[model samples]
Target chain A: MKCPLCGLEFNQEDGLKGCSGCKSMGACGLIKCPNCGYEVPAESGIVKFIKRWRKKTDESK
Target chain B: MTVNLSRKRPQCHSTADMEIDARRSVVLVGSPNVGKSVVFGNLTGMYVTVSNYPGTTVEITRGRLADDSRAVAITDTPGMYSLLSITEEERVARRVLMENRPDMVVHVADTKNIERMLHLTVQLLEAGMPLVLDLNLMDEAERLGMRVDTKVLKERLGIPVVATVATKGMGMDELKKMILKEDILPSGPPLRYPETIENAIADIAKNLDSSYGISKRAVALLLLQDDHEIWQMVRDREPERYALVDAIVKHARERFADPLNYIITIERQRFINTLIEDAMDNDQVKGIPFRERLSRLSMHPVAGVPIFLGIIYLLYEFVGVFGAQTAVDFLEETVFGQYINPVANRIVSSIIPWKVLQDLFVNEYGIITLGIRYAIAIILPIVTTFFIAFSIIEDTGYLPRLAMLIDRVFKKIGLNGRAVIPVVLGFGCDTMATMVTRTLETRRERVIATLLLALAIPCSAQMGVILALLSGSTKALGIFVMVMGTVFLFVGFLAARLMPGERPLFYMEVPPLRWPKLSNVLTKTYTRVEWYFKEVLPLFILASILIWAGRITGLFDLVIKVLSYPTGWIGLPPEASKAFLYGFFRRDFGAAGLYDLKTSGALSGVPLVVSIITIALFMPCIAQFSMTIKERGWKMAVGMAAFIFPFAFVVGYLVNLILNGLGVVL
Candidate 1:
């Protein structure tokens, strides 16, 4: 995912900066948009999975 | 407006995090994996996986749906039971209702389980959320001999209800039309309880001057039952108004035969019964009865704990001993150690002129040598096996039953059954499990669970190595179990005594057990492995780089010197301190580090046992530390750290003292 601030993609969950900032902030549970220091929530995995599933199905069709 | 700390997570927070400002969006909300997401893809014209089952998505997703100027934004929400939140997913769903102020909500229910599903719809209606009810899986419902009366149900619900077979594109146009033309303004009739209760609610509402998004009556009912967030919200809105409201609730309790909340709930059920009478053809038969009976047995006290232990042993045998020991040896020793490492070392020695650059790639402790090797050869294979096993277990619907089974024992230890999720997840990886503690009902429960996880329960990586290390000696395994049990009980007892607030009750829905679908398990395992590999690799490399930097700067030796004193006090070798320190980096890495010590013959029986105990009870892995700070905040996280670091060694020292005093030889 592209970091909003840096426009760089880190092929990982949470922040791309190895969660250095969040570790300091003490909130590694939140998803850090890998590009910009944006912290999003980590909610239910199934819902997000299905959302992705829907997207894939649509694209294939 | 209150600043919701948990809000604004795009990736893990909310599906709509990125798309909130759009003119319109489709919010794909439903039960776990009912193809709401597949339907979302069809609507948005985007690429997303269409999997059978995997309950991993914890956040919202956004996409745009368009068909010739009928453009709308789409959001996929986590599965939730009701508007009255219990789980974090439920809280997120409720927050979406208030914050986004959606023009319409797609209440996707599995058409087969309409009885249980419609309870949430009634709550959404009661909360006055604008909704278009989509009965997804109409085909599956029909195949199961279930027929829903859509038109009558819509009339009864006072909203447009659309029948959708989402995977096949059934009823798309009707659903779209309902979303467009159905009244955005909710017309749900104000549900009335008996006159006695109605009179009480009217009194409560009249006194409650604070205007809420939900009706005051609903808020009043919630407040009496000690809904913390709702109580705080009302307190913030009208600081002086609580006394009178409290009096009203007390008065209602005196008059009511049952707890007012229970009474209100029963009334709501009766209301749902009448609605179903108009809208549903209730099916009395289900195919999964034997499965249901077995599922129930797994949770019963006599059978459940043994079943739980049996499952744990199977997991230990399959994932820990077998996977981490045998499979890992093959991958790490035979494949990577023999072929890859030698080849890479030769290539690096030949190519690099600078000694330091070569050191970074393939030296005694090179990033490529240790980091890449551990991540790929060791952690990769072990976690792959774990994910496959976990996926299979989850697919068979056994985990929830396991939770129910454990809830009884958990209660004795000052936790309820719901604590089972995070505790169980701790076995997978404590970092994610610590984050999952947000699903707990109260702060005290979260704190207690977090502490237990940090102190006693081994994350899967750590479990893998420790299980492997102890595999040779059955006595060693027994001692390990005994030490772990002692720590769990001692810490749990102290925490129960110290933490304030009453223990929250747990109620879980146990889905039926079945033979795990292979295709479903495979997909889930693959996705998890993808997610896991993404998490581990960089951290491993970074850990190596940091250790290298520490070495270059003399910080590593300085800290090792500091740790060695504690190491000696705990009756462990000085080198064991290095392993303990690195254990903070990643769990398995630390264990692997200890393997180096063991191979060097620096640690033997007593010290080895002490070291294992100490590491097991040491501070949480780095990821968990990060999550603890995130979920519980820094003061508590640091305080937990402050207690853990000193306390772990203290326990180790004490264990050594006891063992030595008893003259025990393993």
Candidate 2:
């Protein structure tokens, strides 16, 4: 995912694996950008799979 | 895309062997938001995880690269501006450099920001790391008619420099080749400082026996700049020379009118400018593009207000009407009410003979009936819609412009444009926004932003519900907006006055506004929704259970009776007390309670407006309260809550009193 604030591209996983000191690490579910501390939502696995599948089909067309 | 060096033992950040790897291990380091991760992904495919850099909770990504005989470990560090660290992230990045003596240090920089970004590159060179500078994001830079001479830059710095469009895999082959060639990986001479500073550094470096994995000159420079970590390291490792080191640093500081750190930064900037002068060329046309003009208009004080208001209205229509009314009604009344709830109620009742256990699962506030319903049916659609809209705004690069537009207002509250990030974010979720307040430079700014967020900014869920409640009555909605706006400004001004700190200077790079790509928007929205569900679902269930327990013990009824006094004081009926109590758990749920009242013809006109205003201004939900405590500590969080609870009602009462006095009916 691209951080909108700083325009840095990072893996969604790196974003979700936020600072460990945060009390709501497991539950808050926000992905903190490693560069700037901007928080974005964590994308689900199913959505990612579907999007990839759709893109593949679209390219085939 | 893989480059392999000689086989040797891996050097992790935790290890202190001070053994430089004979085999090639690559470490990527740069300022944050410079596309280091993209470069890392291209270099090492699919072998990455969050590895803590020893004692700190900060995570740096460590990945493995493979070839025919040996595997090299590649570590991607957190963003750091210089060797002198200001943030924990910077400290971790510096530690990774000191502890892991990687064969090649890939300093990734955004090509668009070559001037500002070159300082870190100079710092890395001074540290005596074997450096390969990758100027990433050349595509964006070229689009702006800016050209960088990679050959000139290489000659000027005496290091291997590669220009790359990392996103499109441009210049990857050259970068890979540079990383693999051992002969090309030469240690450049450190940046020479002014003569006086050079003499002081030389005096200090003469006494230092160890560089501790970095150059002795770098250590000497850090000591002169009063780097605490270096001071501590010196105290622990070379106590005999610590006093001498301290005196040299003190003498250096006394010699300068400005702090030595600032002096050093200025010197570095001067050096960087000389380098940039030879390396970069600009041929930008006199006339700006239409997109650039639009970007300017979006930040113009007069023009930007209407655009901002338009965006807000669009947000209401999308998140409120389409999401809250259309999607929520279908999910709530049709899906859950007509199908799921009845089925779940029947199943729980048939299985459990005891009324208590059945009630816990199937009753009005049951885990499944209320909690799951609220999470999916009410909150999900609203948050999803808001996230999608927000992601589009972010991806289009309008946020920085918005920050510029509102910076004047923010200044009145002792905050600069940077505070706009958290304020805009508070609409998504105040809990997360509270956490983001950590990004602010000053304690005073963070505190004021925190107080304003808690007092006036409504989270998406709460905003969605309130918008749904009052959208039918335009007059009521207007009043609600006016009251919240007034309170936001007034409280922010007071807090700014009460707090103490210098107003920070505001400077931010505003990226060119572009059309938002569908893939990016969808991906971001999906990520946010997934995160939102992971956070809100369990909390909603716990809230249901707590409410059920409170009901079973009759505490719920007692609290409702007591709250009715304040409800009446705000000119709302006794029936409104239940909604107010539900609000303590979740703001949206409480607003949803009022929605039920309005539909059933219980709340309307002046009282309805008062109820919505008070609930919007009420203390944030439990998650936000805990986050406030985490970020601002217990005293500030508790104090904020204590002040806000009464203040919400007082404002509500005053609004009600004024409206009734005018004989106004909406």
Candidate 3:
């Protein structure tokens, strides 16, 4: 995801790696941009599900 | 050939006597998302192995080049902006470059952002690394009507330059051929500083006796910039000459008004500008793009205020009126009030023999009736809409522009524009925003930003509840906004005056405004709402159980009775003390309590507005307080709370006195 603040694009995994020391302990579900430390919420399971479903449908088509 | 890709501890200064392999090693390096990993894959194919750089969590990828005849190992280092590292990842990348002494260093850059990317390119050249400049993302550069004359660039920088859209396999063969060539050599430093710095660099380089993997000129430059790691290394390795080098750096620093880092960067940028002038063509359409014009207007001093107010009004309509009023009313009155509460009360009353046990699940303060209802019915709708609106705003890339718009005002408050990032984010979550204050350059700025956040900035859930509480009367809402805004600026100004600190410098990149992608907004909203529910629901239920326990133990009444004096002094009813008590648990809980009071005709008119202002300025939630303690330490956190709680009531008292004294009708 691209950091809206600094325009640095990074992998979600990389963003999570930066969050290892945060007090929220991943319960906050925020992904901190590795470059700028700007936090944005990670995608929820429902959204991921919808995305996967859409991708499967597209493939079928 | 078998390769061990297991994590290896970085040998900072010792590369001698390490096992040497016949395979020529190449390291791919760049800023984030410039296709370094993709280029790595292109060079190495499917035989890649990943491992953490030892002592750090940052990953390193290594593989052999796909060509069977030539034995070549390719390593992809973490993305880094500069050799003068700020982040751990950047430090690791620099370590990889300095320690490995790779036969080839490929600096993959985003072609569209060559201006920004060239800073790193210049640093690589200064290091005298065997460098190849790969201008990746050429398709994007072309789309932006940018053309880089690779031949001219190569000739100017005295290095190989390859342009490729790595994802499309464009220029892969050329890149491969360039990497395979054995003749690549150090391109030498690409810039010369002013005479003072040049003299200092020459002095420092002359004293260095031991070999640093990179050029001694680069070491001298890093030393002049007071690079701590190099300072330690030089002190360790060249102990006798370290003092002279340190004196040279100090003398050089005394000659410049700015820090050597800033001075050096300016000189490098000046060189890059002239270099770019000769080698690149920007054929972007002659006129300013509409988006660019809109972006400018959004940050314009005169025009930005209305745009800011316009955004606030839209938020009020969406989250306040629609979510807090309409959606909340349906969920609270129709779903919980009409259906869930009655059924739960009846079922609990029938099943549970003891009235105490029954009260735990039903009645006014029951876990099921109050906690669940408040969480699912009132707070949920409000925060959901808030998250949706916020996600849209963020996706539009308006926050950075907002930061720029507010920078001038923020400077007066001992904060640079960067503080705006945390302040705006505080609306979403103050706890997170407090954590983010680490990004500020000075400790003083962080403290001021933290105090302001704790005192005046209400999180999204709390703001939504207050907006709903005030939405009935525009005059009342107007006064509420006016009073809170006054307190925010007033306190911030006072904090700035009281705190002794250097004036903060402001700089931020304002990304171009774009129509928000619907999918992104939706996904962001869903994620935030999900997080909100996951975090808040259990806490609300726990609060309810604790409230029940406290009431039974008579602790709740004692606290509420003590709280009532302040509540009454603020012109609020005695019952409102319960909300004040709840406020410390979570700011939104208190606001939700007030929503209940208003609905029951217990709180109204001037008192309602005063209570909202007070609660908004009240001590931050328990989580935020703990975060404050963690970020600012115990003494500072305690001092802030000591000032905030009473100050909140005093301000509330004064607002109440003025409004009633003026005979202002709500």
Candidate 4:
């Protein structure tokens, strides 16, 4: 995911670590961009599945 | 994926054979988010999960290149800015390069940010590693009308430069070829420094006969910069010459007013400027794109306020009207109230028989009835909608511009524009925002920010309910904004005056604005909802148990009776005291309670507006209170809570008195 603030593309896990390190309550479920400290929400499994489905459909077309 | 380095090493090999057949490692290093991972993926064709680097929690990714010619170990180090490490991650990146002693060092850099990233490139060169300069993200650079003359840059730096759009598999074959070759690029000369510093380097280098994985020149520079780790390494290696090295560094420091790191950086920047003059071209024209124009308009002081207000208005519409009134009501009334609660109550009453156990499960403040219901019915939809709106704001890259727009005002409150990050975040969760205050530079700034967040900022859950409560009365909403806005500014101004410290400097990288992707927005909302539920469900259950305990012990009533005095003082009815008491647990819980009161016609006009202002300005929820204590220490957190609790009622009372005295009615 691209960090909105710094525009650095990082894996979602790196963002989650950044969020956890900040001692957030985990309620926001945001991944902090390790590069610029901007918070981004992680993609859900359902959302990920939908995205993959959409891409597969697009490819089929 | 695998954070353990020990687990990652190939096992069951003889030491001799291991030394002979060990793949030549190609280590990738760069500042964070430069697509180093993408490049690594392209080269390796394998999955490498991020894990803590050994004992330290810093994440590092290691993979192996799939090549017919030979096995190549490809390790992607954590992002780092410079070799003179300040952060733990930077130290880890340097450690990977130093300890691995890789055959090739691929310095990946974002093409658009070459000027800033070149400083790291110079540091890498100084380390005397065989370097390949991978100028990644060429697509983004061209889109911004930036063109880098790769031939000129390579010629100037004396390294093989490869331009790539890593995401699209551009330039990977050449990158792989360069990595596989033994003698791809010559070891370049170390970055030139001022004559005085160069003399010091030479003096220090003369005594260093031992090989450090990196060049002696780099070690000498590290020594000059007072890098503690390098100094220790030198002390352990060359105890006899360590004193001499220290004396040289001390002498060099004495000669310059500024630190050696700053001096070195300035020199590197000067060299980069010279390199850029011949290599980089910018065809920036007056015909800016619509997105760029919108970006500028967002940061314009005059126009930005309306834009900011418009965003807030939209937030109120979505989370307040749509989520709170529409979704929350349906979930609360039809779903939970009609079906879930009644069925659960019957089961608990029939099976359990004991009133205490039954109440714990299905009564008014029962864990299952109230806690789960509030988490699912009241807060979830509201928070989800808020996250969707917030994701749009974030993905569009409007946040940094908002920071720039409010920087001038933030400075007056002893904070720079950077404080906008935590402040904007406070809207989502004050607990998280309190923790984020550590990102601020000074203790004074963190304390001031903490105080403001506790006293004024309402979390999304609370904001949703407050917006819903006030949506019916324009005058009430207007007065609520006026009252809370006044307290926010007034306290901030006083806090700034009271705190003594150097003013923080403001600097932020503003990303270009673009349309938010729907997939991203939906995913963000879903993740945030999941996270919100995971965090709040337990807290809500615990709060219910605690409230149950308090009710049984008679403490709850006593507290409410004590709270009712202040509630009445703020012009709210005695029934509103329950909500204020609940506010101590979670700000949203109290606001939701107030929503119940307002809908039942228990509050109206000036009293309703006063209740909204008071709850909005109330002390932060219990979680934020504890977080403040953890981040800022007991005295500060307790002091802030002490101030905020009474201050909320005082401000609410003042607003009520003023409105009632003026005969203003909503």
Best by DockQ: 3
**Interface RMSD for each of the candidates:** 14.4, 3.9, 2.6, 3.6
Which candidate model has the greater DockQ, 2 or 4? 2
TM-score of chain A of each: 0.41, 0.67, 0.84, 0.70
lDDT of 2 at B340: 96
Question: Tens digit of lDDT per residue, candidate 4, span B1-666?
Answer: 122223333343321222223357788999887898899888866544345676566767666664577767777888887898756778888988888888888999988778878888888888888888999999988887677899998877888899999999999999988777656444666467989999999999998878788888999999988798999999999989988988999999888855686578678877887888778664453445567678788888778878887887777787778877888889988999899999999999999978977888788889888888878887787777878888898878887787787676677666545567787668767887888888775677788889989988888778877887776566676677767777887998888788765554455567667788997777777877777677778888888898888988999899999999999888889999988888888998888778768767898888988898888888788889999999999999989888988898888888888998999979
Off by over 4 Å in 3: A10-29, A42-61, B1-28, B35-78, B84-106, B130-212, B217-286, B412-414, B439-441, B472-481, B657-666
lDDT of 4 at B271: 88
Which model, 1 or 2, shows the larger DockQ? 2
- Per candidate, native contacts kept equal 0.00, 0.52, 0.62, 0.55
Off by over 4 Å in 1: A1-61, B1-200, B203-290, B350-357, B416-421, B436-443, B473-475, B598-609, B630-634, B654-666
Alpha carbon lDDT at B454, candidate 4: 92
Please tell me how candidate 2 rates in CAPRI terms: acceptable
By lDDT, highest first, what's the ranking? 3, 4, 2, 1
Model 3 iRMS: 2.6
CAPRI quality band, candidate 1: incorrect
Put down candidate 2 lDDT per residue, B1-666, tens digits, no spaces. 333322332334433322222366788999878899899888767545454677766777766665565555678898876788755778788888888787889999988778778888888888888898999999987786677889998888888889998889999877766666544454655477777788888888887876678778888888887788988988898889878878887787776644566568777777877877777664453344677678888988789878887887777777767877788789988999899999999999889989988878777879998888878887788778877888888889987787777675677666555677788778777877888888775677788888888889998778877877775566776688789878988887777778755554454556668899998888878877777677668877887888889989999889999999999999998999988988888888888778767756899999999999999899788878988998999999999999999999999999999999999899
Give lDDT tens digits, candidate 3, residues B21-48: 4468898999998988888878877665
B489 Cα displacement, candidate 3 (Å):
2.5
Question: In candidate 2, how many Å is residue A56 off?
Answer: 10
Cα-based TM-score, every candidate: 0.62, 0.72, 0.79, 0.74
When candidate 2 is compared with the true two-chain complex, its DockQ is 0.38
- Give the DockQ (2 decimals) of all models: 0.07, 0.38, 0.47, 0.37
Could you arrange the candidates by TM-score from highest to lowest? 3, 4, 2, 1
